[model samples]
Structure formats: C-alpha cells, structure tokens
Target: MTAVEYEENESKLMRKAKENPFVPAGILGCFAIVAYRLMKMKNRGDTKMSVHLIHMRVAAQGFVVGAMTLGVVYSMYKEYVLQPAAAQKALEQKTALEK
Candidate 1:
C-alpha cells in the first residue's frame, strides 16, 4: 500500500478504536438543558401566590442541585481517573519506543 493509504487507514483504525467516555457525559448535560426547558414550560403560569409557584421553585432547585452534582462528579472522574490513565499510556508508549 502507498504511504498515504497506510496513514489514512491507520487514522481510521485509531478513530474507531478510541472510546471516548465523555460523549455520554456531554449527552447527560444536554439532557439537563432539555429537562430545564421542559420544567420552565410546565410552570410558566406559576405566580407569586399560586401553589404551583412553590412546586416550581422546588423543581428548579432540584434540577440545579442535580446538575451541579453531575458536573462535579464528571470533572473529578476526568481529572482523577481519565487524565492519569492517559498520561500513563503515553509514558508507556514512549518507553516502548525507546527500548
């Protein structure tokens, strides 16, 4: 095979081989946005003295809390887990190449 064809195939293999766990994390974030919009729409008629106002406030607070928790967890997982693992992999590759 030509050099260009070999490089192209190698890249395609790499692309398919890498499993990005962050894609689901991003989808979770998008889901939160959708949920927030839906909640707002559901409580659009809530007024200062309406019983629905309290429920709306509670729902919004819950959403905020949940979103914050998810963000913290995702960030901690990426920082404490994913990054180190990737760095170790790179180090191993470098060592192997130097051998």
Candidate 2:
C-alpha cells in the first residue's frame, strides 16, 4: 500500500482504540448489579440446597460476565486513555527536540 493509505489505516485504528474503553466498564457494571441481586436472593432462604445450587450457578455466570467485562474495560482504558497520554507526552518531547 501507499504511504497515504497506510497512514489513513493507522489513524482509523488509533481512533478505534481511543473510543474502545467504555464497553467493558458497562458490562462489568451490569454483572456486578446482577451478582449482588443473586446474592441477596440466596440470603433470603427461600429455596432449598438445589435452589441455592441454582443461585450458585447464577453467581458463577455473573462472575464470568464481570471478569470479561473487566478485561474489556481494562483494554479500552489502556489503549485509549493511557497509551494516548503516553504517546502525547512522547510526541511533545519529540517536538521540543525538533524546535
């Protein structure tokens, strides 16, 4: 590909990376709420061991969801916020040197 094409592709990637952090946080937030609710239900003693077992399954599902959500949020924060801030600092230093 030409230089211009490469640059354009790179810029698109950077923009996507910058905008990607919210999805995981939103997912984690949802799971946390769900797990909390399930735990509450478990505490109510409205079900037998089998019922509690089902609640445990529900809790496990929530845990998996929360973990996956965390992974996404972390990826987004690192790619968009942290990496950009670091890159900006490096770019500023480079510009200072050029001047």
Tens digit of per-residue lDDT, candidate 1, span 13-89: 34422333344444455566657755666556645445555655565566656655766687698879999999999
Residue by residue across 1-99, what tens digits does model 2's lDDT show?
Answer: 422233454665455434554444545666676667666774766567677657666765676666667768777887799989999999999999999
Residue 13 in candidate 1, Cα distance off native in Å: 36
RMSD of 1: 9.6
Strongest candidate by lDDT: 2
Each prediction's Cα lDDT score? 0.61, 0.66
**Residue 14 of candidate 1: its Cα lDDT?**
48
Candidate 1 Cα misplacement greater than 4 A, ranges: 1-50
TM-score per model over all chains = 0.51, 0.50
